[model samples]
Target: MSELKIDERCKSTLKKIILFCTVLFLVSVVGAYILARGNWELIEAQIAQMMEGVMDNLNIETNKNFGLSLFINNLRAVSLMILTGFIPFLFIPIFILVLNGIIIGALPMLTGTNFVSTMVFGILPHGIFELSAIILGASFGVMICLTIVRKIIGKNTVEFKILLKYILKKYVFVIIPLLVIAAIVEAYITPIILMNTIF
Candidate 1:
C-alpha cells in the first residue's frame, strides 16, 4: 500500500511537470511570436548585437571556444534553475521555460521564414535534445518548489534536506547527462548543419 502510494505520488508529480512545461512553452512561444512580429527590426538589431559578442569571442575556425562556452553556459543554466528550486514556488522554472521558449520562438522569426519551417530546419538538430534537457531541468525545479510549497501549506513536511538530496542525486544522474550530450551536439553538429542549410 505504501509503495502504491509512492507510485501514485510520483505519477502525480510527473503529470504536473508535463502540464507546467507544456503551458509555459506554448504561452511563451505565442507571446514571443507576437513580440517578434511587432518589432522584427528591433529583434534583428538585438540579435546582431548579441551575435557580435559571440563572434568577437568565438573562433569559428577552431570551434574550441564555442564548444567550451556552449557547454559551460548550458551547465550554468541547468545549475542555476536546479539550485533556485529551494525556494517554494514555480517562478524560477516558469521563468526559465518562458525565457527559453521565447528565444526559440523568436530566433526562427528572425530568419524571415515561417516559424515552424525555420524551427524544423534550423533548430531541430540540437534543439530536441537540448530543449528536452532544459525542460527536464526546469521541471525538476518546479517539482522541488511545488513539494516545498505543499509541505509549507500542509505543515506535514517531508524533510527538505532529504528531498533536496534526492533532487540533487536525480539531477546528477538524469539532467547532467542530457545537458552534456546537448552541449556536444550544439557545439559540434549544429553549426555545420546550420552553415550548410540555414545560414
Candidate 2:
C-alpha cells in the first residue's frame, strides 16, 4: 500500500512536469513567433548589439573566427541553474526555466532560412542534452522548494535540521547528476556541433 502510494505520487509528479513543459513550449513558440513577425530585423539588430556588448565585456575581439567561442562563453550567462539560485525569491528557478523555454523556442524563428541550418548545427548537438539537464535540475530545485513551502503551510513549522538534511540529500542525489550531464554536454558535444554546424 505504501509502495502504491509512492508510485501514485511519482506518477502525479511526472504528469505535472509534462504539463509544465508543454505549456512552456507552446507559450514560447507563440511568443517567439509573434515577436519575430512584428520586428525580426529589429530583434536581430538588438541581438547584434547585445553580442557586441558581451564581446566587449569579455574582451574578445569581434571576429567571425570566434563564433563557437562566443556561444560557449555566453552559455554561462543564460544558465538557468546558475542564476536562479542567486535570486531572493523561492520560485525564481521556475520562472527562469519558463523564460528560457520561451527564448529557446523562438530562437530559430528569428533567424533567416539559411541561418536555421546553422543554428541547428550550432545549438542542437549539445543543446538538446544540455538544455534537458538544465530544465531537469531547475525543476528539481523548484519542486524541492515547493515541498518546503507545503510543509511550512501544513504544520506551520519545520525543524531546521530535518529540512536542511532533506535539502542536502536532494541536492546530492538529483542536482549533482544533472550538473554532471550539463558539464559533459558543454565540454564535449557543444563545441563539435557548433563547429560542424557553423563551418
Candidate 3:
C-alpha cells in the first residue's frame, strides 16, 4: 500500500479502537446500574462471598495485617494473574467491570444525594484517568495474549519476560501515577468534600 493509504488505515484502526473502548465502558456502566438496581442484597452477598474467598485463599489474619504490605502483595498477585488469565478475561472484562462499577455506584446510591454528589466530585478528580489506565493495561495484556495464542502453536515460546516487562511499564507509568492521583483525591479532596457538605 502507499504511505498515504497506510496512514489512513492506521487512523481508521485507531478510531475503531477508541469507539470500541467507549462502547465497552458504556455497556459496563449500564450493566452495572441494571445489576445494581436489581437485588442489592444478592449483590452484597456476592461481594461478601468473593471477599471471603480471597481472604480464605490469602489467609488474611487481621485488620492490622491488611495494610500497605498486603495491598502491595495483592497488587502483585493480581498483575501475575493478568498474565495467566489474560485471554479469558478479554471476553469477560464486562463482568469484572460491571461488578466494580456497581460496587462504586452502590456506595453513592446508598448515601443519599449530598454524599453521592460529594463522592462523585471527589472521585472524579482521579477516578476517570485512573480507571482508563487500568482498563488499558488489562486490555493490552489480554490483546497480547490473544495474539500470541492465535499465532503460535504451543505456548512454550511465549516470551513471557518481554510481555511482562511491557505490561509492567504500563503499570509503572500509567497505574502508579493513577494510584497517586487517587490517593490524593481520596485523602484530600474527599475529606474536603465531606467537610464542606457537613458544614
Candidate 4:
C-alpha cells in the first residue's frame, strides 16, 4: 500500500501526541519510583508477581528463544495499544503506557542495583528503539481516538478508513522494524554488555 501523506496540521498533531505520551510515560516512571521508595518491600513483591505473571503468559523457556519471544511480546503489546484506540478519550492506551512506565521505573529497586548503572547497561541498549516504537504506536492510537472523538462531536475530520490505513502503513514500515532491532539487542547484545560491565 502507498504511504499516506500527512498534512502539516496532522503532522503537528502527531508530534504533540508523541510529546504528550513521552511526558506521561516519564512522569509515571518518576512518580512510581518515588512512591515505591517509602514502601519498597511491598512494591517489590508486587512487581515481582506482576513480572512472573507476564513471563508465564509469554511462556519463554530459555535464552535460546528469548529474542523471538520478546519480539512477539512487544508486538502484541504495541498492537494492543493501537487496537484499543477505539476506547473513548484514549483511556486504555494511555493506561497501558503508564503501566509500562511504572514497571520499568521499578526495575532498579527490584534488582537491588544502582539506578543509573542498571538503566545504562541493562535497559538503554534496547530501550531506545523499543520505547520509540511503542510511543509511536501509542501516539497513532491516541490520534485515532481523538479522531473518533471529533467525529462524535460533529467536527470535520479525515475519514476513519484513511486514517487507519495511514497508521497501518506506519506500523508496517516503521514500528515493526524498530521492535525487531530492539529484540535482537535486548536478547543478545544487552546480555553480552551486561556480562562485561555490570554482571
Greater-lDDT candidate between 2 and 4: 4
For residue 11, model 3's alpha carbon misses the true position, in angstroms, by: 11
Candidate 4 positional error at 26, Å: 1.5
lDDT of 1 by residue, 84-172 (tens): 77777555877877877776677766667667756766677777776777777777677778778888789553455555666677678
Each candidate's clash count: 0, 0, 0, 0
RMSD of each: 3.3, 6.1, 6.5, 2.6
What lDDT is reached at residue 115 by model 2?
A: 35
Locate the minimum summed-lDDT window of 10 residues in model 1: 50-59
lDDT measured at residue 170 in model 2 versus the true structure, 0 to 100: 49
TM-score for each candidate, following the candidate numbering: 0.79, 0.55, 0.59, 0.91
Full ranking by lDDT: 4, 1, 2, 3
The Cα RMSD in angstroms, rounded to one decimal, for candidate 4 relative to the true structure is 2.6
lDDT (C-alpha) at residue 49 in model 3: 64
Taking the tens digit of each residue's C-alpha lDDT, what string does model 2 give over 3-99?
4454455446645864675466457646765676678776776555544554564423433334445344444543444445434347676666665
Q: 61-178, model 3: which lDDT tens digit per residue?
A: 5433433333444355335434543564244443454444554555443443443463467456556655565455445544455546644555433344454555577677866666
RMSD of 1: 3.3
Q: Record all residue pairs in model 4 with backbone atoms less than 3 Å apart, i.e. clashing.
A: none
Q: Of models 2 and 4, which has the larger TM-score?
A: 4
lDDT of 4: 0.84
Instruction: List residue ranges in candidate 4 displaced over 4 A.
Output: 1-6
What is the TM-score ranking, best to worst? 4, 1, 3, 2
Cα lDDT, model 1, residue 90: 52
Who wins the lDDT comparison?
4
Q: TM-score: which candidate is best? A: 4
Off by over 4 Å in 2: 1-11, 41-90, 109-120, 155-199
Off by over 4 Å in 1: 1-8, 41-61, 111-114, 155-162
